[model samples]
Target: MTRPTHLRIHQFAGLQPGPRLLVTSAVHGNEVHGTKAMAEIARQLDAGQLTLRRGTLTFVPIVNPLAHQLDRREGDRNLNRNLRPPVIAQDFEDRIARVLCPLIAQHDGILDLHSFQSAGQAFAMIGPRNNTGELEPFAQEATESALAGRLGVSRIVEGWLSTYALGLQRRQQRQSDGSRRAQLISDPHYGVGTTEYMRSTGGWAITLECGQHLDPNGPEVARLAILRTLVFLGMLDDAAVEPHRPAQPPEVLQLYDVIDREDMGDSFEHAWASFDAIKRGQQIGTRASGEAVLAPSEGRIVFPNVKSQPGTEWFYLARPSDRVLG
Candidate 1:
């Protein structure tokens, strides 16, 4: 089995006990903005400008260094999927995810870093609000009241990690004591599929999509998000946050399906950025054969593909609802 590797950094201020935060970045190596945000936050905090009112903070930047080094997805596959470990293949992402999930579970709170292919707006992701039952560790601040009051996101979306963890818990409950307990399942929040595995074990986690990939402003937005989280978790005082518009609900939805298109032979005409609405029966794209692909329902595009792989997502159409959000 391939052993997992990770990097960690910490900052502390004052004698009081505060919320412990695990801030991670670069699960997807291309998502460098989050890593930069981590550095920036560390710099500001260590400078003592952004003092921790009550908690410890840890950051793991460049979680998938090999993928970042290659500038390609892990082993030519998307690192965001299939995060089972014990390293049967001894590859990069698997080892990294295996190591990171446990570390995230150790903290009182977590904020994994990420970025999108298209232009993105910063937002806090609250996993489908209801199932905080299994992931009580992560859900300490996941209630609708806390999100609305602190993070300012009223609409709660189902997270891929929350779904997988809850499912495992239910399955394990059905199993006899003699049956082996199920191991963790990795998920989207971390570059590993196993974030869900940690969630199933009652861990806390959140994936923060800072902004557009490679955009000049991406890092700054990520940096701001981290600071905001610190404040929301009571790490910093309100003075750190500049007065801004409250975060509107993000269509509160689940990831009902992800349509992974195979190859560039299929072309999508026109621009379809994230949050752009699509109507039912609208022509979203076309195949090389000129066959039409239509929207199944009236919904908005969550993650559209300008860059994609053959047999991978060209983009995903998200149905805004609890049942479909995960």
Candidate 2:
């Protein structure tokens, strides 16, 4: 089936001659914070309170509008996964990415905003394990610090999706040298699955997980997250904004791999915290063996199975993303 070219709605005209900042929200649909924040910021700019200064500002305020309406994780269809130019470019995410990426690249960096499930805390995902060198130019320390200020949390996950995407670009540059037709992963996916795809093509992108989905203030917090990202990317100066800082640093963790179970699916006991420790081979939960089930492996039970949809991950295990950083 063919997809629509422009699901065009309200166009912001020329916010700039070229995009200086690209703030996208709800790429996952259910995550609503970024959209609200972007809209509010747009309103402020219209009100003459905030300034765009030099470069343009672009926003895909509701990237996956269909999925956002449904409050689902993926688009009712999978528009995000296939981001390459030729293959069904009209699909939702692909169309938006096509329009969004080049515009974002016109600027210094991008601030792709996001939020997480209700159980999770707010943190910024910064990555590419080895690409902090490149990120240094894009995301200066003051900017990162300013982002930490707005997020109200100091926990920054290194080697994030965009970081790794830049890492892949570095690899491609080394191989072909000055060839734009280099062989590169279209959507740079780290072991972290869906989110990192934009990093490779979208210059510097970060997935800012802003608290729980159901929280009344999640949207507002998510908006601040985008501002912080802008500050870090140098689009916004630190003195212009005030970011709330969490006492001490946020405990950062590496996202290992998502875990899944078949029969009776993965489960856990009530009230276990996200970073809680578990013993090797300890029986954390069970599956219906029609008998006695067993624990699979050992690490610490990560993202844990909660009472929700069937296939939406039971749990995940991780050590840390920084431990391996060079």
Candidate 3:
């Protein structure tokens, strides 16, 4: 069966029925690698360079076209954050979510392509490990992590939604006035992204950050990730993709907390990059009140954003995990 391409979505289905997979890119307007890679894959399919072996593969090259049109991270709001269909469609991103959320829910699995603002090696972010808790009841961690390890990246990060939930809780306690809260989406699960939303609908997903936004190697990284995932999922033939093996076993990191900027004057101790290691008691930054912000433990910093507004996450802290990847 053929579905006509619309809303920047390209669908290719095999004659034999199999798993349905979704691949999305440019959920953040400024992330171009995914879009570039998607275009290449589409071109290959059109030119008969690659063929869908046994499944339906869908690609949304520009999930947030308004943001992509402006060449910015967002047009009105971050589409990647607070990702769910809005009842009223309040903002530009909300409208995109209305269309995107259902597309995500129907897939068996997904690989959301993204690029970060900071300098860092390409890594994959998986959802939390399964527990009895209701906040994030995920039983697909093992399945997701195994797929992540084969994505040509040597690092995997989890605990993103859990860490952000803690940050939101801490922010609410410190903030007396609701002024700062108005600046962000009001959802308690504000950290729910493409992958999280997919997990909620009983589909496993992975967010593959393919390197810095403008990294010269970004497109290739994204392209390889797509191909590797298709082959690993048995949707494409292994001969269609290059053999990928990291130099060592991938390092799994558990993000424990987010450090929010308290005031406009707060700043970091140095020019920090993503995955920079921190030692206990080392001053990582200075608070607005003139006190040094010291590391609570020996770990690594992730997603250090100098331009974050007050009461928003400035950086994240993570420690090594003992997760055994399949």
Question: Could you tell me how far off, in angstroms, the CA of residue 106 lies in candidate 1 after the best superposition?
Answer: 0.8
* Position 271, candidate 3: lDDT: 87
Model 1 poorest 10 in a row by lDDT: 179-188
Local error of candidate 1 at 244, Å? 4.8
Q: In candidate 3, which residue pairs clash?
A: none
Instruction: State the displacement of the C-alpha of residue 270, model 3, in Å, after optimal TM-score superposition.
Output: 1.1
Q: Rate the local accuracy (lDDT) of all candidates.
A: 0.60, 0.53, 0.86
lDDT of 2 by residue, 9-126 (tens): 2234343454355667776788777788778877877897766554556677777766776777665344444443445554356556666555544544456666655365666665
Best by TM-score: 3
The sequence of per-residue lDDT tens digits that candidate 1 reaches over residues 1-326 is 33334445555644678777777776676788878777777787779777777867777787777767766445434556555554464455556656765666667666676777776565455444444353434443343235333443333344554444443344344433342111222222222343444455454556666667877877876676677777777778979976335555345666554554544777766777776778989888887678888888887766788677543456666666643222
Candidate 3: 10-residue stretch with minimal lDDT: 178-187
Give the better candidate number (1 or 3) by TM-score.
3
**Model 2 spans with C-alpha error above 4 angstroms:** 1-19, 78-83, 89-107, 131-150, 158-195, 237-239, 244-246, 271-279, 290-302, 305-313, 321-326
| Model 3 lDDT per residue over 64-149, tens place | 88877788787677777688888887777877888889998889999999998889999999987877688888788778978998
Q: Pick the candidate with the highest lDDT.
A: 3
